[model samples]
Target: MANRWIRPEVYPLFAAVGVVVGICGMQLVRNICINPDVRVSKEKRSSAVLENSAEGERYAEHALRKFVRNKKPQIMPSVNTFFSDSNRD
Candidate 1:
C-alpha cells in the first residue's frame, strides 16, 4: 500500500519533471524580478573643482603646494634587495 503512492519505475520520470519545473519557475521569477524597468538610473553629478573660478583655482593650488611640502617622501625598499645583505645597505 505504501509503494502504491508513486511507482518505483515512475520515480525517475517524476524527478526529471520536477527538475524541469523548478528550472522554469526560477527563470520566470528572475525575469519578473530583474526586468530593466525595475532598475533606477543614477543622475550624473558635477565636481566642485570643475565649477570654481580663477581666484578659487589660485587658492586651491596654494593649499595643494603647502600640503605637498608638509608631507614626507616615502622610500620603499626594492624587493630584489631583500635577500642580498650588501644590496640592503
Candidate 2:
C-alpha cells in the first residue's frame, strides 16, 4: 500500500518552509548579537557630559572605574579536590 498521508509532491513545500524558518532563526540570532543593549546605554551615558564640580568629578571617576572593572574578564581559580587537579592543562 502507498503512503498517501505524505505524498512526494509536498516534499518541495516542506523544504521551502524549512529554509525560510531556518533563515528567520539565524537572522534573529544575528540581530541579538550585533545590536546589543549595553551599547545603547553606553551611548546614552556618553552624551550626558559630567559637571566640572568636585562631586561630579568624583562620581564620574567612580563610574569610570566601575565600568572598567565590570568589563574586564574575571579569572577564577580552578576547582580544588583531592581526586583531581583541575589546574593541570
Candidate 3:
C-alpha cells in the first residue's frame, strides 16, 4: 500500500496559478501608475500642471496639506498614510 493524498502533480499546478496571479497584478499596477490619465480627471490634471509650473514645491506642499485634511476623517486611510508610516518606522 502507498499514500494517496500527496500527489506529485499538484506542485506544478500551484506554480502555474501563482505565475498567472503575479502577471495580472503587475498589469494592474502598470495600468494605474504608468497612466495617470486613467485615474486623474481633466480638472485635476490642469490644476496639477498649473501648480507644477510656477511654484512647484509650494504647490506640492499645499496639495499635500489639502489631501491630508480631506482624507484624514474618512473611514479608510489614504495611500500617503502607508508611505508616511513606512518612512517613520
Candidate 4:
C-alpha cells in the first residue's frame, strides 16, 4: 500500500545521516570561505593553492585558543570548588 514512506524505526538512521551530511556541508563551505587559493569572487580569482603558512594560520586558529592565550586554561570551575568558594565570600 505504501508507495514512498520510511518506517518509523528508520527515523533515527535518517536523522544521523542528515547530521553527517550537514557537518560535511559546513566543512566544505568553511574551506571555500577560509582557504586562500579557493577564491569565490571572479575579480580576485587565484590559479593555485597559496603556500602561505602565516595566512593559513590566521584563518585556522581556534577562537577558544585565542581567548585563552592571555588567560587561564580552565573552561569552567568544578562544582565542588564553586560551592566551597561561594561560602568564603
TM-score, per-candidate, Cα-based: 0.36, 0.37, 0.38, 0.54
- TM-score (C-alpha, index-matched) for candidate 2: 0.37
Q: What does candidate 4's lDDT look like per residue over 3-74, in tens digits?
A: 357778888999999999999999899889886657888765644556778977887686867877886556
Winning model by lDDT: 4
lDDT of 4 at 8: 82
Q: Tens digit of lDDT per residue, candidate 1, span 9-59?
A: 999999999999999998777555543333233331232133436645564
User: Candidate 3: minimum summed lDDT over ten consecutive residues — where?
Assistant: 47-56
Q: Please say which candidate is ahead in lDDT: 1 or 4.
A: 4
In candidate 1, the residue pairs with backbone N, CA or C atoms under 3 Å apart (3 or more residues apart, or in different chains) clash, namely none
Better structure of 1 and 3 per TM-score: 3
Ranking by TM-score: 4, 3, 2, 1
Query: Order of candidates by lDDT, top first?
Result: 4, 3, 2, 1
Q: Clash totals for all models, in order?
A: 0, 0, 0, 0
Residues 22-44, candidate 2: write the lDDT tens digits: 99998777555443322345555
Error of 3 at 70 (Å): 50
Tens digits of per-residue lDDT for model 3, 20-76? 999999878866664433445656665443423444444345645967775556565
Cα RMSD to native, each candidate?
A: 18.5, 12.8, 13.3, 5.5
Per-residue lDDT value at 59 in model 1: 44
